[model samples]
Target: MSTPKLYAGLKLREIRTNLGLTQKAFAGKLGVSLPYLNQMENNHRPVSAGVVLALAREFRLDVTELSTDDAERIVSDMREALADPVFGPAAPPIADLRLAASNAPALARAFLDLHRAYRRTHERLASLDEALDTKDATLRPSPWEEVRDFFHYCDNYIDAVDRAAEHFASPAGRPGDPMRAAQEALAHQGVTFTRADGPWLRYFDPDTKQLTLSSRAPGSTQRFQALHQVALLAQNELLEATLDLARFQTAEARAIAKIGLANYFAGAALMPYRLFMAAAQETRHDLERLADRFGASIEQVAHRLSTLQRPGAKGIPFFFVRVDQAGTITKRHSATRLQFARFGGACPLWNVHRAFETPGRFLRQLAETPDGVRYLCLAREVSKPAGSFRAPVRRYSIGLGCEVQHAGALVYADDLDLTRSFEPIGISCRICERPDCHQRSVPPLERRLSVDPGKRGILPYEIGG
Candidate 1:
């Protein structure tokens, strides 16, 4: 077998910049010529063993982080972006794509941004919002997706906000009853907390000093909403400080992101980082057990698993996804290599889609991505009752999984073969490299197709061999 080439230009450049060293100085320290260092930094050449040692010795850098899957992540993201069909059949060669991903990641991000603008414009034109009024309309990406990407790249964790929440839920602060604690906190500001029979999830009356939660919502949801209100009331300044640092591009994005951050605070506070993490480790991450222990729903527990990236006190990195019956990703966040599709729907072959059929029981899959990474995936359908039969029920399937390397830590992985068999799944059909997939939706954008009417196999057209 051929040796696997190491292309870590982004990480190399980051280390060089962080150390404030010039290319000549860096090369000297690494015992290489300046031209060689430049080539490596641009990913025109692979990072050598000598440079890896030099980095460890000179900067005390973790060599393991240097060998990360940055190239793979970027290549996956770029492939998905280029598969828009607007890019047409004239996609760049794989070598060029890899070069762009490693050497100039910023340009790749810029291209993705430009495409989002086009997609937003296309969506608006199709919707005919205001009937081509063109009033107060400018070319920009969908603010919601923009905000989502902000959190996506942040690994769905904010240290300042997460720490503040841990403090709030600490033993000294967390009261015997979370609802009572919220009432007391709000009462200090002359705000009263109560439940109301209403269509909305949560409502606040500023003039009447009242915070009202929906009576129809589940008890777990009500607790979440109460804590979310507490975040908005008690942690506005800290939230604002974090927002200022993020510097979102648009006001709508800022507003939506503020709510998202508040929601994060609510989940973190309700579960409380240190305690929840301990219970997760002890229970082997049993969703039902954690939910019962923390008075949270299984869905809430699953969602919180994705946000456990609290630096030195981190838990297992998990990817969490929630899909509606129509296969829309209403909520998604990943701290693993398996990022959910940003635009297109997920693969039909994945077990998450089958989750709706198996309600209450968890569905497990040992799946592999095109990048050769495997995961122990778990999915279950969760329902939100409308409090009465007169209204519609809100139903969704939640997916949670970690890398197969950590599968032993999960109760769901017991008796599962992590070595022998695995299901092949991709970010989506558009970018999947699996040529023999019987369920492929579209030929990969990066590959060619061959069609002969007289010949056929699993598919009418044979992908490039």
Candidate 2:
């Protein structure tokens, strides 16, 4: 029987085009020659295990995707091509062809790249199809959700580092600078740092066994780099261990979880849990002074402050949230048992939205829900790191809040008038049954609308009035 031809070549070409990358550029990125890339795309090669692993690591791709059935089919096709008897005496033996496919480094790399591209395309198409089939297509996870989850689970831990910094800053002789200690810790782990010129100046070279730290300065972002290094070393094992425990079904899910756990560990490592909690209690959760002492961003300080809710050693009871200019909640962590609406839209009149208009300036407000539960909020715009001038994204505005009675503890409420009536807002339109709210993007799924012209309300038309 004739061997069934695999369209691996076509898939490779399609992915290259989809990413708008030239054959040469793709080859360079993969650390392979153009001819080798072309040969793999043409089904003149078979993938090997090492190259498959390399593709997964380099592209942050799923390993299962790189070792698909399509790759097996391509291998079958190559075998059939070698057995054809047309070339006669000058033709290489089938054994020779098999050896070349198996041993040739370039051919192995090409096959791996082709397989990886195919897997990525296949998964993307499947996600789109699933999105199309769902009712209330808009109900599907938004880009904001993905971004927020990425940060949350990926364990981006500036919180932990800042906590560590604060912990060591006591009267019993400071343990050098927290940043210097972090740097020293990284060096102890055999990770060397060097200044480089690039958008991603910091990259780990597994081959050279070096973690190069970039010198790109966003004003006071140097301390962040130091903390990040500490995260790489101190939190690496913990992050890996957490991911191992997660046992995610898909490689993609596992990859994301691994990143999240790493960030979490990073935060935990930076802020030794016990010390940070103690400091929070002592200062009543003053973010500015906390940030100053730890050399961390305010957002980092606030996030750590919220995590001090351990069973016995709790600090201030608070909730933390981060939103962009579009009022999208990118990060939400709460110590209180308050229910937060996960999807739909957020309130535009909230202090979080107002903070974006006055970037870098902090704002304070007292918010009260229908249940009469009042809270104090501190909102400020946190600048997003720009990758390049051409693709600039908006800075984020994050809000940190606590119960109204705990307002005196925060610096934001000290100067502001507590009696002023601020706009009342909810987490999202679906959970919030508030009528006449102009910010309502979509009505609640469970709420039935009444359409009487005379009795029509402003926002939600009244559920079965």
Candidate 3:
């Protein structure tokens, strides 16, 4: 596969400005002409190896920060935003989109903001006249989506929160049960806890200094809720600080993000990063074994595995996704080149869909994304049983995978050939580039289609160039 070019224009400019260096002086220091430096700074030219070396030597910069992460994120979000039909068939080419994301990152963000506003306004009013008459109509990213993107760009790991959770779980400078620690800490705070069969999962009555946990919930889930409440009660400042840095557009978003951070803390605490990483390595990443060892559910283990991105000590960069029976992506995170569709659902061709048919068993797929990057994907059904049989069962399929090179680390990839027999997969039909997919629910917005009444193939109509 071809490697994507790097563009660190924004980062380079920030570093230069932060160091208070003139463009001419910076160019001289980097052994490049002023015009050449200008081109690189503007992303018209790739930063050269000599320039990279110069930045490291002169500024003590961590060259790894010069990754294409920012540009890639912007490009992915822009692609999804542009897929909206309001943009029509006149959307810019992928090459132009990349240029905009790389060379004018701020403008690209502004465009996304405008699109978010357009959507919010469109949802609020039925007609243009109604829209014009509304006095308080404002545009902002949907709080939930904004938070999702925030975590997405963060590579699904909040270092501070994760470390704090690890610390909380580590009593006496040793790994211990976080749930027990939370209980002990709460007791010291004059808060008493109890378990009961109830309609609510957890209820904390601050006035009475009582926390009620559901007896019906699974042990792992109960533990998670306990830790989540602990995070809210004890770590409010840290959670708020993280959200403040995020600066979400709406209070609802901020509230939702607080819960998300607590969930992160709960998961991290249940499986302390260092101990969990060691166990994962020892077991070849066997989900069941890790879950048993950490006293976490398989789903929790899978989710935590995707968040092993703690800089320098990063694990295999895996993508974790959970889809309900309807194929909607309920939860997702990826640190790899492959990105999931922001709208609609996952590719029907992917094994995640098939996981529902064979419940209670793990399914494996050697799959390739539309970009030709391959992954060794694993999928299994996770079911939540209600207290009584009369209540509904919440069922979802969990998927976890990393690129082929990292397959060796997974126990699931024991006998499979890493290089061949890969199934083709795409993000979603709306953005998928494949023309002959039989399971496509919709034609790609990026391509035109032709209707051939007399001819038929995997697709009912031929795709136009």
Q: Which prediction has the highest TM-score against the true structure?
A: 3
> What would the per-residue lDDT of candidate 2 be over residues 240-301, giving only the tens digit for each residue?
55556645444656666555544554455455566666666677677777776566678878
Worst 10-residue lDDT window, candidate 1 = 131-140
Taking all chains together, each candidate's TM-score versus the true structure is: 0.87, 0.60, 0.90
Candidate 3, residue 171: how far the Cα is off, in Å: 5.5
- For model 3, the stretches where C-alpha displacement exceeds 4 angstroms are 15-38, 48-64, 123-138, 171-173
Error of 3 at 143 (Å): 3.0
Better of 1 and 3 by TM-score: 3
- CA lDDT of every candidate: 0.83, 0.57, 0.86
lDDT of 3 by residue, 189-277 (tens): 78899999888788999899999999999889889999998889888899999998998878899999999999999999899988889
Q: Encode model 1's per-residue lDDT on 99-203: one tens digit a residue.
A: 887777788878877777677677778887653465334355567887887887777888898888877777574434666666777788788878889987899
Count backbone clashes in candidate 3. Answer: 0
Decide which is better by lDDT, 1 or 2: 1
RMSD of 3: 2.9
Q: Rank the candidates by lDDT, best first.
A: 3, 1, 2
